[model samples]
Target: MEKNNRTIVNAWCMYDWANSVHALVIISSIFPVYFSATALGASGTPDTNFFGLQIKSSVLFSYTVSVSFLITASLVPLCTAIADFTGKKKRFMQFFCYTGAISCMLLYFFTKDTLIPSVFLFGLSLIGWSGSIVFYDSYLPEIATEDKFDAYSARGFSLGYLGSVLLLLFNLSMILAPQFYGITEKSVPARISFLTVGLWWILFAQIPFHYLPAGKKKEKRDGNWLFNGFLELKKVYGRLKEQPYLAKFLSAFFIYTMGLRTVMYVATIFGATELKLPSQSLIITVLLIQLVGIAGSYIFAWLSGQIGNIYALMIGVAIWIGICAGAYHTTEAREFDIIACTVGMVMGGIQSLSRSTYAKLIPENVTDTASYFSFYDVTEKLAIVLGTFIYGAVEQMTGSMRNSILALLVIFIIGLLLLYRIPSRKVYHLKLDHREN
Candidate 1:
């Protein structure tokens, strides 16, 4: 295999910039809340009361996402394996990205008091969005030099944050100028803004498809693609047993990633439910996080360069702890400012470092990068299960998301402790001898 150079690395990083618009708009900022309050099947005026719980639109959106994550968890690894066997990571990425964009565009068709279509579209979009990311993530080693893994990974995340910001600015413009843009109503502007993401995602996603190289196609190793995919998973499991430190790092990452995912997924929801903030406020808050995230990525990248990956990751974990604690204790809108501050500071660092760290652990010559990343995907999917299940259980039993927020402390603390036990320097020296195709 040829060594990856700087140009390839930058191209790979740009893929993040392309797809992140979908994440920022459909997943994080505008659509979820819209889906809850207006998109789906609800009676006249769109009932806010469901199952004796009266919560904000975003919290309902979070609940729906938790449900979708539960389903996606069960299926992504198998899908990943198939993509690997077919040697079509880039193609598969394109397929899913198109589906997600189409799903996002479908949001515009959702009418008042008819949310079923929107809900379905949201779920489909989530699946397509997340599934494509597994393949996108697997391509990191193909584009990054071993020594520059951290820098490249951080670059991807930084570009992604910037991309999200640009889209958000456009969205904010559409929203503010709805009347000028032919939107004559209150929520129509936001709905139209949601449609823009699908367009942006599809347009920008072409860059990688047009420019970045895909790994070579591979013949099926032992059986049919799906069957062989299943077999590949078992082999991965066996490999994990021999790599206990990597396994341990994975275990720690799984938990903390879950906590991070849950906090981000539910932050806007929690604020709307607990703080009773309006939609406009939520938009402003998310914009603030996006801006802060840009600064945060560079800060952590520089910090990691000075102190090492472990130190940078620990800083992120510490901020997470602070975020959970702040959420648990705050009673006013100002508290959201605290939560946003911590999240903006740490989210990119944690994700970028985790991906690069795992890239280091994996051998350079692994043929089925998509299949191999299936293990990584499983951990990520399972993290959602653990975090959401625990959060939902606590919230239902205690009747407060505050208690749920506090519960994440366990995930962070324990994951951090386990992370401390891994010897990064030793793992970094491991040979990359697995080259079978």
Candidate 2:
């Protein structure tokens, strides 16, 4: 019943802590690195069969991500509509959460031989993780005040970074010291890590699952879900059409974050296949990124207060541009680590600020939080679809992921230009105030 109770807020943030291991272990660190190595045999040919045709494994992995997001983008709006119409947000969130955890556990069986099944399971895990977050993010405006959005968002990310780092350290210990665990095959440790990540996700999620409030009790009898969802989406679009800043910000967010998401998704692949960095070094590098991102989240949240979210995001986007350019020229292990660490510095900050900024932008009176946040997430999934697809396509065509860097750099530049067109904090507030009064 309380609006900003510490207990409720902490419970909400714990969801971030729950699901973040998926980001660290599955998507970012161990899994991508493992996939690349597994696909590239001892002879080191990157080509693998995907349906009778040979496709580069890294590019296939990229397509996997893009496809998962495409499905997520399709499903999110309809799911959110159901959640909002029936006030069953908690139920929908739990469904996705458990689905993702089980999907992740199934990934323990993924090997070079079982590539297709594994890839689909991996896609399912992605869909589940991403879907739950849409419902989770919609809770922000309902639970926290505008002034606290940045702080709460940053804190949530900090907790996620900390929890993910702790789990990753455990997984790394197993991977790096397999003999100590009596593990014979190198792949065993990584496979075990996948199963553990799923269990961890399910375990930590209970804390928030028990504490966060379930929404409206009203039940909808209409079975026309597609039609009903379209109606909800139409309302959301109408609202955005009225708010120029929100619409413009969404555009910029989509463009720049497309590049950002692609880099995060494929950075491990690049390091593994392109830079020829060992898996150990790649995972360690990710750990470093996670550790630094813990601080980055709070740092950018504070910076947002000082200079406004828009300007702070612009600065972060500029840094991302530099990262892409630097990565293009990087050939050594040490140089790649530098680029990765720099990515950490802005990764959390940019993401946290973006979510909070969107929360702050949404008018206070609107109560269909699930539908609104789904629209925001739809933008993200679409961006990721385009970004990862382009990355894969470029790599497949050019025989190198380096060409993808040029594409990402261009995306950041366009996003920054669009961001520049938005009104400053003072002007944005005046506009919001004018609307309110």
Candidate 3:
């Protein structure tokens, strides 16, 4: 395998570094709490029940997320396919990355009273973040040798964790240092922190923009581009049926990713609502997870070298089951740290390894990377829909985060079993012909 593209490879990985901050800061960290408590702040008192739901706010959160998933599912693959056909994966990436970053910058306007523009910005940011990932992921196989794929894939995740930690640290400093730093919650520094995330994402992302080689573009349909994009997607749907291992991998990916996503979306909310932890403490714990996550990503990358990618993935899923089960028995903040540490270890590896594995398995079809990876993108989105709502419903019914966490083990277990049923040797053996294109 040729191995001289370090600059290009690292640049590609840094896109994860750039974009994941938005995921950590905007989507995962500040925005959820902001939306729940501040953005949707009612004037005097709020209704406890709406449409037969007691947790009206949580229900709204769940509904908004569901709709986001549907839109992303329908659109993302086509977006990916267009990138593939036009050989514009890089261009598509720049377009969406900026869309997401600009949206994060706009979040500063969302104070107590203004909500719609804020929500709209957040939603568009979600779309941009997700849309960009479709092509960002498709670039994996193009830039790496077979022997290097797992480590390099894991590298992206590791860098992403580091990026998240940097932004989180800066944000934490702003919130904690109002007196010493001349920053206050009601003033510009707090708002500047939000703007900083957008700047971080956009500026650092230009590294990849400069280094990576352009993907090959095929001539699209002779007809209209919109109609052509639809036809290309249908072609992709047919192609998926032709590839058995790819289909199997995707199915397993969907189930396990659902469990992973459920843990991500609900863990903090559970900590704050059920364990009675303060917001400041909950935020600190999450930042700690990001720091620990940097170590975890490299650990799994090394482990995969010794044990192989499939077995490493199995180890990750096994850890998820334990993390969920452990949450059931936890009664204190100390216990929360244990579960959070377990998550930090497995989350990066599972995502990175799964992606590299798929990159290995995809057939040497010319100009179908986006269209194919779109299945990957949409399945990832649907996982959020299934997991969040299921977790929310279980919590609503039992009125216990403990039961909800325990139930998530079923998804991890089933996905693990399905993953084991796939032929591991085939993954390592997959090859592409340079002659195909």
Candidate 4:
């Protein structure tokens, strides 16, 4: 790979800006509240039956996210592996990105009459959004040198935060002041917000699609693409065992990500259910997080430069432990707001540093970058399944989300310990095939 080019790097980062609208509006903030209000009615609790089982709205949403992760975890590796074999990662990324954006647009049609369709589209969009991320991340190594990964990764996340916040602010205006848009009902504005996310995603994605370089080399087509892809992935898995440093990093990543992802996905619901916050407060809190996150990503990136990525990540994890504790004790809206601000500061830092740290750990001269990132993404999605499951199960068993939040402390601690086991200097070596080089 050549040295980093400014245009390509900017283009790559813009995808983060593009897709993050979906993350904020559809995944983390708006959709959850809107869907709960719509489906469960004014009680804000789940009274609806799914497959003959009565479930709470929060539990139902968590399980829906788990199912989406399950499907993505099962399928993304194979898809990424096939893309690597064919050297068409860009095409694969485009497919997932467009699919996800269109799915967001489809959410406009969802209502009480079409609950099943809503759930299906929500899951589909999640899959599309997350699946595209695998290939998007793979481009990092290709676009920038290892030494620059931290800054580039942080820039991408910061841009994402800023872009999403801008859109969410507009969406909030529409929801909070519907008369300004000539809308009479809240539901109409909420549905229109979903449509805006899809349009924004599709429009901004074109910049990256146009500017990102194509795969440098192409593998010859064998009659058996699926079989070849699996064989290739099996070989990569075998090779991964020889890289102890990378392997340990991945272990820590998987564990910590469980806590990280669960918090990102469920914190809004927790605020609504446990803190008894209204929609306005929850949306505002989410906006604050995004605003704070822009600084968090940059600050953490700088912190990584000062103390190293590993130590910076450890600090971020420590803050998460504190946040979990605070969440357990929070009863007032003010207490929750303080915790939300803390979460915002650490969330972007941990996520940005983790990506750069992993990028630095990857073996030099590796060819199947997409497949490598597929393994990374699959680890993350599976962790999400485990984390969301534990969260939902704890709530069901204990009859309180407080316990569920506290349970994350164990995961964070375990991840910290695992991270400690990794050597400060990169020690693992991987030999590349000449064909791959």
Top TM-score prediction, candidate number: 2
By lDDT, the better pick of 2 and 3 is 2
Candidate order by decreasing lDDT: 2, 4, 3, 1
What tens-digit string does per-residue lDDT give for candidate 3 at 396-416?
677676777777989999989
Which portions of model 4 miss their true places by more than 4 Å? 41-45, 221-223, 426-437
Using TM-score, rank the candidates from best to worst: 2, 4, 1, 3
Please list the Cα RMSD from the true structure of every candidate, rounded to 1 decimal place.
4.7, 2.4, 4.5, 4.6
Q: What is the lDDT of residue 404 in candidate 2?
A: 92
Better of 1 and 4 by TM-score: 4
Of the pair 3 and 4, which is ahead by lDDT? 4
Give each model's whole-structure lDDT.
0.75, 0.92, 0.76, 0.87
Pick by lDDT: 1 or 4, better one: 4
lDDT for model 1 comes to 0.75
Cα lDDT for residue 69, model 4?
Answer: 91
Q: List where candidate 2 sits over 4 angstroms from the true fold.
A: 41-43, 218-223, 426-437
Compared with the true structure, the alpha-carbon lDDT of candidate 4 equals: 0.87
Clashes of 1: 6
Model 2 / residue 209 / CA error / Å: 0.6
Evaluated at residue 366, the lDDT of candidate 1 is: 72
